[model samples]
Target: MTTVQATFDSVDPATGEVVGTHPIAGPEEVQAAVDRARPAADWWASLGFAGRAERLGRWKAALTRRAHELADVVHAETGKPHADAMLEIILAIDHTAWAAKHARKVLGPHRRSPGLLMANHAATVEYQPLGVVGVIGPWNYPVFTPMGSIAYALAAGNAVVFKPSEYTPAVGRWLADSFAEVVPEQPVFQVVTGLGATGAALCASGVAKIAFTGSPGTGKKIMAACAETLTPVLIEAGGKDALLVDADADIDAAADAAVWGGFSNAGQTCVGVERVYVHERVYDEFVAKVVEKAREVKPGTQIGPITMPAQLDIIRRHIDDAVARGGKALTGGTVGARFVEPTVLVDVPEDAAAVREETFGPTLTVAKVRDMDEAIAKANDTTYGLGGTVFSKSRGMELARRLRSGMVAVNSVISFAGVPSLPFGGSGDSGFGRIHGPEGLREFGRPKAIARQRFRAPLVLTTFARTAKVDERVEKLIKLLHGR
Candidate 1:
């Protein structure tokens, strides 16, 4: 008897519509994909900066032309509004263009100044592609987030084998297929469909590096699996991101940012505002404005359904825990089958699970802090620090500087993700390593430093045939020239 591989369906979380069926790639199949990519990686890397940029330019144009069509797929698979889906696609396109236009300057060879002792030698360093990059993408913001790594890796001249989340395989397929229409010669960019096993296979398939975006627990598992081969991995994990509203902050703007940041995508964003730290003088006003905005944005309208049903249970548990621990629900307090109403809680303790944990749902805990210092303290008191926002008229930058997070938006939320020049990632459990901007270009490549002698030095310190007289003369010269 022969064994048959398993298959899974991508269903719409809101209406339970079967969007597409994807094969569960087993280890052998996963390894096969990586094997096919090895030669393609070399071929792609052979395309120097100018050649790769031209190919990437065509791919970017393809993505830009078919962006709306792709956004429809994203909306169908992830249940986000078509407009929001387009927003993500647009950002991905911008990043793709940025990488293509700037790759040469960021990763191309550059002269390095040699030290005084090595002035006779010339030094140059350039970033080289890491061959094959395995990207295990998250379901939420599926296209935008993964494309950050995917575009940069490709622009840096590496083949990519992507494993999208099981929930949104169709979107992943759409991306790869779109790219193929532009560059059809090789499997430079391919998608492997499956669950956790397929992802693990990619990690152990000897890919040069793995870029994973998901929960920290799964990140740890990926790290452990990659340990066997010592494969490098970049983990963009969970974030309990916080929003701070100082006394001088524009309360309306803060409330708007909090509402959109926390409730958009049904609160499935890793950088969503899960907690609000407001100065005592403005805490009451902030809560009132947030409640007003929360009521205005209804699920399935301004917000969307929870893409991952399992996350609904986590949201429920967090709300239940918060309410039972002396917290009051200002607007929403209940959960539904698919959509979670925008919920706001007050009088919640800092120790409450809702505040301390990553409730990847549309929920916010509002707390009163004596001053901006206390607000900063409360915001930094978390295991994950992916993204943060500060809404203050006078002290926005000052407070933003003190936050322990990789990316922060002053007077805004999640704007850092749009700027193609800014790097994105986080410290701690939010995960290390960066994507986007120059850092992203370097992330997928290794520096190749070259040193060559311009002319033979009179001293010949590196020569094996140094005489005692030469050594004594060098020592005397060094002491006389540099001795204190």
Candidate 2:
């Protein structure tokens, strides 16, 4: 009997326009993609470092030649401004180039020093690709976030099967199609579009590893699904990131960073500043500056509509909850059908959901702290520790070290994310593992250690022919060398 296929619509959140219709990519289709990746991984790996790098360069050129086209797809699906979409693409292209340029150096065999016990042996180590990687990407930053894993995985000689966020499948498809233009003979990178069940199918599809980016609750569910097969997973989950402004910080710069970090792309960024802690001495000044700057920018003009309709309800609820519990809206708190004006709240309870949970909206709660110690404490109090920003002149680095988040920016906002040399991920509830930089390249590969003997020892201890006297002498030598 012929079975029917399932499909879904990709709607433009801003206008409710049907952007496209995509096949639901059920378990069978997902598995087929993985099956294709296995052979593709072999073929791509056979190309070695030089060949793959050359092809990747072509892929990068293709993306560069038509960057605006891909960005258009991103805007249609996510409702983010075209410029913001281009920014995401630019970062992603830079990361892709970095991966292709550094893959050989990062994953190639490197000489290692043999220990004293094995002085006659030469040691070496290299990173080998894990065959096939399944990536579940996010919708907010459709191009950049998944490319962190995708580009690195391909550079490391592994094939990729990506499940783009159901909300932004067309963006993912565009990326894959452009890549196919370079490596048309093989499916080095493929996209499987669908909802959560499709992602779950990829998780259980026997891929070498699964890289997921989404909320912690969904992360937990993905983890559970992967656990059934003992499949290793890397999760870049939701974050309740904070920005701290010290007494001596440049209030103008701080306010600008806070506004951009808090409301950019409708504040759906995983590393966006959801909370702000200001020194009590300058709290009022910081609030005034932030309010003044926020009021100047209007949603739908400067910012774009919320991409997910369901998230609108959540944003409204969080704002309502903050106001109901003694919180004051400093500026821009009204929520429209598809857009939420930039909101800055003061006097919000520390325990309120708006402050404690991951609002993931264009909203921020500012709190006054007695000192930097209290600021640090309050910033690290959340269960989520992903990325954070700090605007301090004197103690930027010193204070950054105290925060529990994985990546911290001192005197700037989300700058670490753009630097190709810096690793990006999170700690605690934000999930584990990393993507980007050296850590990202290594994430897609496994280390293989090798030892080759240059010369045979006159008296080998590993053999059973060794006498007890030799064993006794070795024990004495170990005791003399190690005993304190």
CA lDDT scores, all candidates in order: 0.92, 0.93
Winning candidate number (TM-score): 2
Worst 10 residues of 2 by lDDT: 456-465
Instruction: Point out where model 2 deviates above 4 Å.
Output: 1-4
Q: List the residue pairs that clash in candidate 1.
A: none
Query: How many backbone clashes does every candidate have?
Result: 0, 0
Q: Model 2, residue 130: displacement in angstroms? A: 0.2
lDDT of 1: 0.92
TM-score of candidate 1 relative to the true fold: 0.98
Sliding window of 10 residues with minimal summed lDDT for model 1: 455-464
TM-score of each: 0.98, 0.98
